[model samples]
Target: MDATVNACIGSDRLFDSPTTMNASVAIESEMKWISGMRPILSEEDFFTWMSLIIYVTLFVALIGIISNLLVIITCARIGFSETINISYLALGIADLMASATRFYGSIFLLFEITTTKVHFDPRTVSSVVAFLPSQGFEKTAAFITAFIALERCLCVQFPLHVKTIVTKRKTIFSNVIIYIFAFGPSNLIHMVYRFKWVYNATQNRTVLAIDQSETRLRYILARALYAYYGTILNFTALIVVWICTVYLVLGLKRKAVARKENFKTSFIKDNKQKDLQVIKTVFLLAVTYLVCSIPTAITLLVPQFVPEFGSTRALARISRVSYMISGLMMQVNSCTNFFIFLYMGSRFRKALITLFKRH
Candidate 1:
């Protein structure tokens, strides 16, 4: 999560300490040494503790990648022709890409801390490698989730019109638009605003400067733009998905009740049961997304308002650990859609079985 790096940056600004870079490098070297040979019991065994965290994060990310990939292949093999099926396939691919990005970020961080001597710098290393790709994929996943939720809500609320409205071509078009928006101009702005190497005349060298602007106000504005991109857009989509899920559930219940009372409903008749099943599946997906995302959002948002949260060493350490846990949860959410499909979508489960049997 960018929250981790952002928190560090925020902390650096608040302290206004010239030794911040040196302190960071010393900490990194100490951590590497601790993870290697000597075990330091001071400062709550920070290095040893963080090493455990890195290993655990790596394991979970690998599992996530494999699970998302399997879902993609299964969906493609079994569900090539249906519109909703194709959407699920697209969502699965998006999930796979997301997991891959996260997995790469995790490996890169480990490599930097374990192998590379240079201190971890968010400006140059994180921005280019982890920050942009992860955000792109995360936004893509969020938008596609909202897309699926909206499609299901419409199909349940107005079944007949939905078929005409949400054709294969239109669905594909919507996905392309999502991809474009997820990786478009705002992200380019982020790449430009994040970092630069500025000459320090006093130090007689170039130092990596992040979020530097001509004016403090402009710097704040730049950070706000990135923050909104990272948190707000995704949260808005989550809220929409939640609302759509609720409407869909109520609609499904009403129809089920009407059918029980022998009252015929004037809507699409052929796929009520199937549509209900899909609604159930999407409902689970929405809930999972909310559960996993809210923690990360909180982690990112709170520190912005309470800069003091990361001002102290102890607090910063705690924030780092919290960031890792929340990050893992987000990754799990991205990968576990496959399990949700297996649980709620009987068709998906049967398809998986058939796919394996064929092989």
Candidate 2:
């Protein structure tokens, strides 16, 4: 589940970067490990497959950029209100950033692979690769989803105090905090450790290599941090989202039933129905996030629990394929949220149309 696209990381020929003997040995060991694990494929065949994967991933990244940009624009046009539009706007902005970075990496990789004579700045490439995914926008998006769902739950349970408890000011402040926590620490360590200008013997030039240090403790701690923040925290947030969504839905249904029993056509009943629709729309978004995230989470977590799984070449290949599928699912989820809004949010759809007309 290595989503970052640095060439020097986990790559063979790119390791010509000068490093400590320990780092060099580690690089050699990785090369040997990859050689043993690589599935039997012709050079031409492997590149062809890689090309296809790169192209598809790039295409999805592009689509996500456009779609999320539209979502952000629409959110801005509609203005924030009580319907978790602020959360959607935050999510859209985060996804837009992630998609744009992914697009750059994919396009750069494609160009690098297709060209025989390499002419690129490794420092720039390594910096981008190390910094882009490290920004933790994905985790921010996940957190925002959970917050949105939890807010809905609170609204359903305490509609009378919803305004007091969940003010726009509070929401904005919380979002700022999320951005600070999500985007800062995860990337700071990566930015510090990943960039180094080293001589590549094969390329016969100085190239910047994004390589980890020989400090096993540092590597282990980084992985631990990643597991804690990227996987465990996200999983926790998702569980909260699921719980809140279920409670909110059941509460809404019960209220709707009570309203129906009291009167055939009451204002409260109409409002309840509309609220239910909005909740259901958000529930769809939560479900997509949950479903799409499972594969990536499993792929990331499985090896920790099942140490022998990666020992087998066949299992490793299966894991790689699973990761690719999960990555694609994530990309699709990011790209299609605007479409979901279009389908489920009447107000959002009208706002989108108005935005287009204004342009």
Which one wins on lDDT? 2
- True-structure RMSD, every candidate: 7.7, 5.7
Encode model 2's per-residue lDDT on 159-186: one tens digit a residue: 6788899988989888888888766555
Model 2 segments beyond 4 Å from truth? 1-49, 115-135, 211-221, 261-270, 311-314
Query: Candidate 1 — which pairs collide?
Result: none
lDDT of 1 by residue, 1-359 (tens): 22233223222221121101112322333233432333223344544555576577668768878888878888877755667777787777777776776676666555534533333443344444454456566667778888888888887777669879888999999988887877553355444455657664333566565544446654565456455555667667768877887887788877777545543454544355566677788888888887887777776677779764444443545555556566677777778898988888777788789888998
Single out the weakest 10-residue window by summed lDDT for candidate 1: 14-23
TM-score, predicted candidate 2 vs. hidden true structure: 0.80
Deviation from native of the Cα of residue 291 in model 1, angstroms: 0.7
Q: What is the overall TM-score of model 1 with all chains considered together?
A: 0.74
What is the TM-score of each predicted model, taking all chains together? Answer: 0.74, 0.80
